[model samples]
Target: MELAIVGLGRMGGNMVKRLLRDGHRVVAYNRSPEPVREAEAAGAIGAYSLEEVVERLSSPRVVWLMVPAGEPTEQMVERFAALLGSGDILIDGGNSYWKDSVRRAEWLRERGIQFL
Candidate 1:
């Protein structure tokens, strides 16, 4: 599967590496450019911005978030919801509150984006 990962923290960076090792095409982005460079060196496509990340993927794009919970995750979700089209998938890989996850899922669903 081809996907874009919006956070390149330790866990996110590792996920990108593992996904790439598994033959998945990963588009990597980070708040800081260093991690993106590291991911790029590991054979993942590096994205400097959310727009670049979205543009790098094909239709029915899949975006996974490994950002901090609460505000950061919320911000990224909203941003991606705008960048991604219907039929796209948004995955939250962080340790978020269950209720927040449910709310996010419903909110994204209403916008025709699948949330997980």
Candidate 2:
């Protein structure tokens, strides 16, 4: 499977490594360049921005976001909404409140994107 992961923090970074170990193609991104470089060293394709991450994926792009809940996640979702097209998938693997996740799911669905 091919996917893009945004945020290279502890859990996210490990997930990237595990996915690569399992033979998945991973496009990894981080706000700071260090973690992205680290993920690159670990055999994942490093992307500098969310747009570049999207560009690296095929149709129906799958994105796993591992940032913190509140504002950061929301902003990330917003950016995905702008860059991604219909049929794309956005997976929020963060600590977002259930209600917030629910709301985001509905919103993305209305825009023709799948949110998990």
Per-candidate RMSD, Å: 0.7, 0.6
Model 2 stretches with alpha carbons more than 4 Å out:
none
lDDT of each: 0.94, 0.95
**Per-residue lDDT of 16-88 in model 2, one digit per residue for the tens?**
9999999999999999999999999999999998889999999989999999989999999999999999999
Instruction: Give the C-alpha miss distance for residue 108 in model 1, angstroms.
Output: 0.8
Q: Write the per-residue lDDT of candidate 1 for residues 1-116, one digit (tens) a residue.
A: 89999899889989999999999999999989999999999999999989999999998999999999999999999999889889999999998999999999999999999999
Give per-residue lDDT, candidate 1, residue 81: 87
Best by TM-score, which number? 2
Assess every candidate by TM-score.
0.97, 0.98
What's the lDDT for candidate 1?
Answer: 0.94
Highest-lDDT candidate: 2
Could you tell me the TM-score of candidate 1?
Answer: 0.97
